[model samples]
Target: MLIDWFTVAAQALNFLILVWLLKRFLYKPILNALDAREKRIAAELADADAKKAEARQERDEFQRKNEEIDQQRAALLTKSEEDATVERQRLLNEARKESDDLRTKWQEALRSEHQSLSEELTRRTREEVFAIARKTLADLATTNLEEQMTDAFIRRLHKLDSAERGELESAFKAASTPAIVRSTFDLPSAQRSAIEGVVKDVLAIETHVQFETAPDLVSGIELSANGHKVAWSIGNYLASLQKHVDDLLNVPPKAATKAIAPPEQQANG
Candidate 1:
């Protein structure tokens, strides 16, 4: 090592200058670039973390919306099922009511038809019985029957009470035309004379007489003065007999026996 103080001093100064230049131009610029790159990388990492959090929130929200839609669909299905059940019950009730109505109408129609048929049968039976009775009586009629009827008429006129006699008298007096004496058959002169005499005696009115034959009387005498009438007929007896017979046939056994007993007793008496 040489001991040269002036030369050493100059070399040391040169080495110091070189070290300052290297620090200012090379080391300082490299350090600043590295620091700027690290700051940029940190900012990018923070932005990536924020975007990841937002994506997770959107995924959670979509899941929740799907669950809500499922609940709404279930509720709608339940409501539709309930409506269908109610509608089915309403239709069943309406059908049952209509069935009942139809059944009632059918029963009523049946009853009406039965009643009509029964009434028609009863009417025809009554008419036939009446015709038979008329024919039988006409066949049995005779001169003796006529005589008896005439005599009965005369007796009835004689037996008239005061009120009936007065009514006949008033009718005869009010008549502008002759009083009519009608019978089913013509009468003999003697019977007519007798009837005229009895009318004059009982009623005490001198009235003209008109004797006429009316076959519709069946076996009867009918006298008409003004609007008043006096009549006696075998048809009345026949009608009473027919009614009694009808009652006996139509009634129950016990009732028929009791009804028949009365007529038999009356006839015997």
Candidate 2:
């Protein structure tokens, strides 16, 4: 019931003073520290998040670069393979062309060699044949060869028919112009008479049969009349043989022609 104003006043003042001390020392200081801690934590978390994002970006960039490098390597390998294949084909083609050229050259060489061999063989054969023939003919030209040939020719002339006899008479008459019979040697009396009788009998015409000795006719007879001359002589036969001897011997012209030719002819004067 009694009112104590001073005590009430003093208590009120004490309570206000306590409130000020709490606000200034305990409450204010605790609040300030908590705020500072929260700010520091937020800063630290933001820094960590930024670092993680940077790491992820770096990993993605590295992967992309690696993929690009792989693609470039694959392309280079493929190009190298194609180039190698092309080079191999080119080399093979070149080798084949060279081989073909070599084959053609070898064939040509073989053909030329064969032709040369054939020509040589032909020439040798011909030479051998002609040499054999010449030797055989020379052996047949014995001492009795002239008598045998003359007798045989006369006998063959006797075998002629009437029409052939008339032809022979005309031939002989036309062939005896100067009528001077020449001989290589003096004939026996009996032989001369026999020859005259045969000529008169066969031709049925006779004038005179004259004889002269001449050694140049090589032991054969010659008759000339009109524009014709008939000669049966060894020298003439030999000359005819010499003319074609090169072809018969099958030797080169220079060799065969020089070997058997007359001295004046061989000199080509």
Candidate 3:
């Protein structure tokens, strides 16, 4: 229990020295290592945060790009569909036009064939009628009819106007060949002499005369002087009748009506 100041001071000094040693060598070094580790960990954490932000930005950009691509694909698909629809319509229209054209051609062909058949039938009928009439007239022909026709021709010649008589006289004067009188049948001697006298008296010209038979005349008489001819024939009346019959049947008209020369007009002459 005795108070030892020397010992106390010495112990205090020793304790202080130990504390300084621990602080300088152990505490300071440990504190420096911990501070360095903490500084490195803080730098690492900051780097990780920056990387995470960059990754998030990249993810957002990728999503936006994906959305844009999807929209583009949809637009392309829509455009393709529209184009296909238009093409389909165009093809249908072309097909319809072709069908109409074919139908029109078919109808035209049918009409043409029908018209040709009608015309052929009409032609055959006309020919048969002409044949029958010719045969009938030939069967009905008589000597009395011939006499009457010869007399009628003589009267017709005498009835010629001044101008016609002058033309006949001039033709006879200029003609180098003899005049010919053609009939369906031979005229009697008396009828021939009567015709010769009438021709000479009416025309006031002297020309040689010849009589000839022409069955094609078909109940007709024809007189030819030079290139001029005068004729009267039942064939003209038959032609008129045939034309009227064709009209009644509603046949197509000919290019022209056949002309039958009048008594006062130039005929085959």
Candidate 4:
């Protein structure tokens, strides 16, 4: 209003200087402190998140290890059961084999004992029968029986077949020792002369004959030249009877009765 230009220019210069001082000292310092606090809080949050992730990974690894241990335990149990079953089967087989072997041995032992008993029984029976027959024949022997036996021996020589005659003749001719005539009893002079005459006539050769008394002949007469022999005896008949008895004893009881006569009846006949 008064036309004072100098006073107005000085006041405007003072206001500009005040605004620059406020911005440089007060506003700039406060803004820098707030930015530093925000940076520190962000760094703490990132560290907490990294720690939580590591803990989760460790938990997962522990669970996997527990599952693997469970599988290993199950496999071990199955293997043990299989092994037990195999062992049990092996034991059963061994027991069965032993039982069969024992049974077989028992049967064989029974068969062997039965065979031994049968053989012993047969032998005893044979000895007793032979003893009885020998005693009976010996008691029945007589001088008349001896004479009859001598006559029978002579008849047998006369009835010889061609083969027997030739064998006897050859033996007599080739003999280095004299022909022997044996009897259970001594021959009477008449009987001896008859025998000598008959032998010479039948053979048509001059032959030396020796006589022998043999108690074992059992009412028998025998003539032997070299290895050839002609004989007649009650003992021969008894031996044939014994053979038949032996055959009967070997057969079963039912069959034996139908097969042959009893030993006593055979002896009497």
Pitting candidate 1 against candidate 2, the one with the higher TM-score is 1
* Clashes per model (N, Cα, C within 3 A): 0, 0, 1, 0
Q: Write the per-residue lDDT of candidate 1 for residues 96-152, one digit (tens) a residue.
A: 999988889998999898668755554454445445655665667623555666888
Evaluate all candidate structures by whole-model CA lDDT and list the values in order.
0.79, 0.65, 0.78, 0.75
Name the regions of candidate 3 deviating beyond 4 angstroms.
1-7, 113-269
- True-vs-predicted CA distance for residue 6, candidate 4, Å: 80
Model 4 Cα lDDT, one tens digit per residue, 1-269: 88668877877887787778877887787787778777777777777777778778888888998898999999999998999999999999989999989988998988898678755654455445445645665677623544555677779878888888888889999999998998867877777777777788777668988899986564467889998988876666656665686676678986766558787876886
Q: What TM-score number comes out for model 4?
A: 0.41
Runs of candidate 2 with Cα error greater than 4 angstroms are 1-31, 120-269
Instruction: Judge candidate 3 at residue 170 and give its lDDT.
Output: 82
Which candidate gets the maximum lDDT versus the true structure?
1
Better of 1 and 2 by lDDT: 1
lDDT per residue for candidate 2 within 114-232, as digits (tens), equals 66775555445434433554456567763343343345434644666788666656766775443444555565565456556655676677746676667545545543334433445
Q: How far in Å is the alpha carbon of 36 misplaced in model 2?
A: 3.2
Give the better candidate number (2 or 4) by lDDT: 4
Decide which is better by TM-score, 3 or 4: 3
Off by over 4 Å in 4: 1-143, 254-269
Worst lDDT 10-window in candidate 4: 141-150
